[model samples]
Target: MDQGLAGLIGAVVGITGALGAAYLAGRGQREQWRVQLRRDTYGQFLARTKRAERAGKAVRLAMDSGRFEPGLYATFAAAVAEAEESLALVLLEGPWSVASSAEDVVRHLDGWRWVVELWYDGDGTLTLERALESAGRDEDRFTQELEQFTNEVRRLLHGRDHTLTARLAYRLAARHSA
Candidate 1:
């Protein structure tokens, strides 16, 4: 082979390798950004949930102990509001499975908050005991759903596929809709 042709071939290979590496590097950085964004959104959601949960617990304790502080309900409402705000990120960025679970968690949390609010806002018809019991049940269900959501997120972060149950349900729902 001619020396000039050999040098040209070597240069071409080197340039091709550089381009390939750059493409791969760019792809890897994009993936990392996505992962970081997911983690941040998940963390925000979980943090807000925990804050709301704490406020709810405080309200429950107050109700159970027959002491109604003026600001406790407001605090719980604020926490729930913060949580709902954070939920938008989850809905926007999460995978379908994670988004769905996050939605369920938010719904359950809202349901619990609504029940608590009703006890406070109603025309004095709801018994405290009954309201507490119902709220307790809702909170329990919310906690369970949140735990499941957290686990789903963990699986997603680790690059696991959706659970079989989720896939089956999605397929069944799609089939029914069709």
Candidate 2:
């Protein structure tokens, strides 16, 4: 992903995890939930992160070349699948307490689906400038949404007293440059 989006997302991780983040809170202790959520959230992060990188790479390829050809939808499909699976896990595992702004995640999924539909119509004929504009707009919107959701999650997670998992996330996040 571009530095703008990457920085945006890194900040978001701290912000969202603390926003009463959606968590599987059945009979487990809060720490347990936090630990599990840390892992799950990281997995979700990796999937979306890769998707962002792939989309950015595809755009660059198209821009560098003369034609609009790079598997946009195919890459987006992986992101869609990750989001769907996360939702499913949230639904199936326990009563998911939604953090504020995560509803936007669902909205992003819808927007991505629209992007896929646009791609299905044949991007070869689409103007490269127009296509890039569309992609940049979509990426901006979704990244904003993801940033907000992540801020919420960070808020929820970091608001509590430090636990092993929380400290681990903190250390890991600290290891990176802003």
Candidate 3:
């Protein structure tokens, strides 16, 4: 082979290798950015959900006291609305499983709001005790859904290996309970 042709081939290979490396690096960076964005959105949704839960508790407290505090209900409603807005982002940034869990969480928040409304309306049907009980159940369901969402987020950011480990642990616990 000619020396000039050999030099040209070597240059071509070196340039191609550099370009490939750069492309891979850029792709990795983009993926990292996407993960960060999802993480931030998930955190925001959780924060809003917590705020709404706190507001819901306040409404329940007023009900327990036998007071019709519209302001408390309004605050709770506003918090729920904000959480829902955060949920919109979660849905947009979702892997479907995470979005579904978030939706469930929001649904429970809405259910709690409904219970509060029914109590406030006072149609002589819903007693304060029942309303409180319903709220407690809703809170429990919300907590379960939140944990599922967190697990899903972890799986998404980490990998399927984490999910497998979690499933194995859950099965072991269930077996022990049985």
Model 3: per-residue Cα lDDT over 67-176, one tens digit each: 75899999999999999999999999997999999999999988888888888776969988998999889877876676677678778888754655655664564355
- lDDT tens digits, residue span 1-178, model 2: 8999999999899778755355434435777766677658645753654454355446445554655444655565666666655655444433244333444565665564565456547655665566666756665666565555555455555564334454465446434512
lDDT measured at residue 71 in model 3 versus the true structure, 0 to 100: 94
Candidate number achieving the greatest lDDT relative to the actual structure: 1
Which has the higher lDDT value, candidate number 1 or candidate number 2? 1
Identify the candidate with maximal TM-score. Answer: 1
Candidate 2: regions farther than 4 A off: 1-35, 38-46, 49-53, 60-64, 70-72, 91-100, 109-113, 119-127, 160-178
Model 1 agreement with the true structure over 61-136: per-residue lDDT tens digits? 9999999785999999899999999999999997999899998888888988898889999888889999999999
- Candidate 3 Cα RMSD (Å): 5.7
lDDT of 2: 0.55
Q: Residue 101, candidate 3: how far off, in angstroms?
A: 0.8
Overall lDDT per candidate, in order of appearance: 0.86, 0.55, 0.84
Q: TM-score of each candidate?
A: 0.87, 0.52, 0.85
Candidates ranked by TM-score, best first? 1, 3, 2
* Candidate 3 lDDT score at position 104: 97
